[model samples]
Target: MQGFTIIEIMIGLAIGLLTLLAIYKLFATSEGRRRTTAAVSQAQTAGALALFAIERDIRSAGLGFAGMDPAYLGCAVQAYKRTGRDPAQYSFPLMPVQIVNGSELRVLTGSSTNMFIGARYSASASGVFTMERSNAGFQAGDVVVGTSDTDPGNCLLMEVTAGAGSDITGPGGVAEDDPTVRHLSSGYTSFYTGASVTPERNGGSSVDMLDGGATSLGEGWLFSLGNRPTRNVWRVQDNQLMRYNFLDETDTKSVGVAEDVLQMVAEYGFDKDGSGKIDKDNEWTGVDAELVASKLDRLMAVRVAILVRSSQYERDAVTSAAPKWANGSKDFVMGSGDDWPHYRYRVYESVIPLRNTIWGQQQ
Candidate 1:
């Protein structure tokens, strides 16, 4: 039998090793391409889904509730939750005429958000508020905001904690969420005739109490804010788009809607002179100057941008430069912890008109 030379055996081994190395390289390249494509597709879907959700809500902003009238824009709301984790959650000046990322989008959403105030709600009383009739049109746990006939700017929010007749109490007045405390110890049935209410006294450029007593809220109109007002707030956290129903009155945390989201940017489109149109170049702004209560009425539309990042990692840099749009109005930014160039990004943008408020202006 003839034996093969050691040189021939060595050459055969080397050729086999080279072929295996080539196969491995091809596999790695194919796998990398597949992952990048999947990641890009996922980021695209997330951006679109998030944009659609936000757009739908912004387009339906306030519906017949807060967006029905321009006067209600930036309306001051004082809310109290029964089982709320934070005391400062429900009280603030809502509807600043624009919505943005890292910020909140608050809109009143429900079936019927209107009613008539029956009597004067003496600030001195608690546990009960009366409507035009004894019927409790407002069910228990319904969140209601009462507007003062004397001052529409001054509003009080309360949750019904009692049975039929829809009684309300000050904060801590109920076993749970009674905001009108007087309603808790309110003795009389049907309607509690508490101590006489004093009118608001002013001058000295300050709001004063008459007769050195708590000023009464002259009940004018009652707006049912629903059981736990839907004060929807949008946020971004942990590479996800988060939504916190700030007024749900529960200890529930914010829910995530989209994945791989980096950040969001939003701007305002104003009518300026109530032209029933938006002056994009002259009046579109993201600054706080337009955040004032007086400037809110001029708000016509909102421009929003949502950036989403691909989750796949590449060995080489994918993005060579920073991203910007609309003449650098929205500059793309990422946290320092990111290896940005190794990832891809997608931007979803739109200009949503404040249709409800805009219609109100046309009238």
Candidate 2:
């Protein structure tokens, strides 16, 4: 067999190299497109899942607290528990949702209260109080809030204890220390076995105000948060949606729900003029100090927006601008040092009605 000419061989090699180059370029472009598509899809899914998880809690934010009168709405609930001080159990605004420092979202939710717990009651600074209805709900380890009849300046928070009432009496009887004081009791030694007294959060008394004295039928009411109270705080951390349970003292760690989550923004939709409807769009948005308690009662709905980013980084700028929600009323903010432009983003927005608030208003 004769060897091919050097020129022909060189030409063939050149053609082969060109073909290889063409294949490489095509493969690279296809891979880039595939990655971009995957990233965008992931972002959409992540945004959706994050919103679902967060809205679940936000929907039921004020379940137990919604039944309170307007006077008690803004009351800074004073609390005490034998266990370590949980922020939820301590002093806090009596609102389902409270936005702090502009970005952090605090969503408060308690277990469903019972008929026996909702009835009118009387409270004393001594922590002893009387309930008008059956004290069947009261139990050891139960967290209870006593709203004062005389004044709503503050609310008393105390945990039901397993300790016996007094030396010469039991619960529902005259206090041994002071024979005149008689607070309602669970009528049992313990509803929850490990119940005890908690130190006042502010080194104050068990109650915020004096005992109601109108034949012990005080306007004040007691709300017992049985074992299943939840105080959840939601925020975006490190491109991940993280949630921390303020009520739970055992696990201090935050649980991450969605990946590639960039930021979450929420707007408050309130009946500004008490029209029972949100007349104006974006009128009084956000849960600032003014949007809580009574104003929060006016909050008919909440508009939540979540911005999610893609896991894939692009060589070229995939996102031209930051995502916006609420008709550009709010936008995702990527602080310094973030390679935000090299990523893709998806904006998910939803207007969630505060059903409890809405239902409360109807009542």
Candidate with top lDDT is 2
Scored against the true structure, residue 187 in model 1 reaches a CA lDDT of: 24
lDDT (10s digit) by residue, model 2, range 1-363: 999999999999999999999999999999989988998898899999999987898888776667667777767776544346444345666777776655567787767455332546534434455445445555555566667766677776555543223334558885453222223333423444533434222234544354645555445776665546677888888888888866554235788889988888876788878777887864656647557533656877777888888889888876777778886776677766558888888888888777876776556
The C-alpha stretches of model 1 lying farther than 4 A from their native spots are 67-72, 88-90, 96-104, 111-142, 160-219, 249-252, 326-329, 335-338
In the order shown, the candidates' Cα RMSDs to the true structure are: 8.4, 5.1
Report clash pairs, candidate 2. Answer: 81-198, 82-198, 129-183, 268-286
At residue 61, what lDDT does model 2 achieve? 75
Off by over 4 Å in 2: 84-89, 113-117, 123-126, 136-141, 161-219, 249-252, 292-294, 334-338
- TM for every model, in the order presented, reads 0.72, 0.80
lDDT of each: 0.58, 0.66
In candidate 2, position 154 carries an lDDT of: 79
Q: Which 10-residue window in model 1 sums to the lowest lDDT?
A: 201-210
